[model samples]
Target: MQTVCNIEQLRTVVNAWRQQGLRVGFVPTMGNLHAGHISLIEEAHKHADKIVASIFVNPMQFGANEDIGNYPRTLSDDQEKLVAANCDLLFTPTPEIIYPKGLENQTFVEVPDVSVGYCGESRPGHFRGVATVVCKLFNLVQPDIACFGLKDYQQIQVIKTMVEDLSMPIDVIAVETKREASGLAMSSRNNYLNDAEKATAVNLSQTMRWLASQLASHNDYDKLLQQARAKIDASGMKTDYIHIAHARTLEPATQNDKSLVILAAAHCGKARLIDNLQVELD
Candidate 1:
């Protein structure tokens, strides 16, 4: 895949693709290539003629104490993975290029409501950084369609809300969360886990799944979520949250809400793990 670090070069290639009557699909990521990221490109292949992937470890999305400096960077390995996934173009811009005016002065995008609570509460200004960088990428690449992994259930909702509120014409596709055989969702942060921590990590997804099964039988949202959180804490991880919410709006789930999502975030070792399970009631 051809990699470009500047907007001029990226737009030049994009315009050339447009002139060729090619439909473009974009996948924006933060390097440390894994199966979850590759699945996005693979999903994009079905929707567009050409695929574009970007790897910029967005500083805005990370919290003040978060691991921005230590976030994994494997450009060469990521490039090989992208090429193997049949990605046509890769945009690997520097933070300077992304926030030319500096983040303090950079024009940012915020999708209200959906951007509140959950990760929004867990990481203040996190979605602002996410929306801003994604908005910038959307403008820079201007693809006909973009793909995001559903592992980030709330994030995909925020992006969808942003696109609709802003009236961006691109189609946003949500791909299923890629997981290991043990049910641990694939994540760049998984690299932080030691052998023992990795073993405990799968319990995050296990707890989520167990919560989902409990939801299937009844609608005792608060009790179920509390039990799930306790279960996670017992697994040797500190629970951040284990909430059952409306799948679409992300408001706390109710008995009347047919569509629901169980989201959990916890701290284990050097990694903070997140996982979710979606349910559609009959």
Candidate 2:
């Protein structure tokens, strides 16, 4: 796999591929590669003639008290995993290379109100940081298609809006969240879970499933949120939020429908895990 750190070199190589009539695919990630990330890369490889994967631990996406300093970084292992997945190109740029002027006073992209709830409410400015960096990467790679895991369901929605609202030419695709046999959604942060906590972590996904089953019989949205929240709280996880809402608008659902997302976020030991299950109440 060819590793290009600078933008110009990567762009030149991609342009050469395009000139050869190759369709390009892109996967943007923070390092500390896992099976979930590899699944996205594998999807990209299947759909495009050339695959480009980027690993930049975006500093702008973290808040003052967040885990930026403690976030995992295993670039050597990450590179090996990408190469084994048959990735053609890897762009692992330094912070200075990605944010030359730094995040302060930098022009950042925001997705507005949708950025105000769930994970965004718990971590202020998180999605703004996400939107800006994602836009930057999109411009840098300019691939024919990009792949994102639905483990980050809200971010997927925001990016969909950003691409449609801005008319970005790249096609955005969502890959299902890869999970463990216990039903815990795969996440890079799962590394922080201790043995006992890891076992209890399965409740997050389980609670979401329970919510979907209840939605068919119960019409009370507030009660649904309360029940899911109680389950996570009882699991000994530090509850961030548990919500069932319109999958597209993300507004709290007033009645059951065919489109909804049951989302949850919590802290177990030092790791913060998030997961969601989509429901069709038809």
Highest lDDT against the true fold, candidate:
1
lDDT of 2 by residue, 111-214 (tens): 97677699988888889989999998999999999999999998998888888888999999999999999999999899888889999999898888888889
lDDT of the candidates, in the order given: 0.91, 0.89
Query: What is the Å distance of residue 170 in model 1 from its true position?
Result: 0.7
Model 1: lDDT equals 0.91
For each candidate in turn, the TM-score is 0.98, 0.98
Q: Which segments of model 2 are wrong by more than 4 Å?
A: none
Local accuracy of candidate 1 as per-residue lDDT tens digits, 1-282:
899999999999999999999999999999999999999999999999999999999998998899998999999999999999999999999989999888888888988999898888999999999999999999999999999999898999999999999999999999999999988999999999988999998889998888777776866788887888888889899998888899999998888999989888899998988888899888
Clash count per candidate: 0, 0
What TM-score should be assigned to candidate 1? Answer: 0.98
lDDT of 2: 0.89
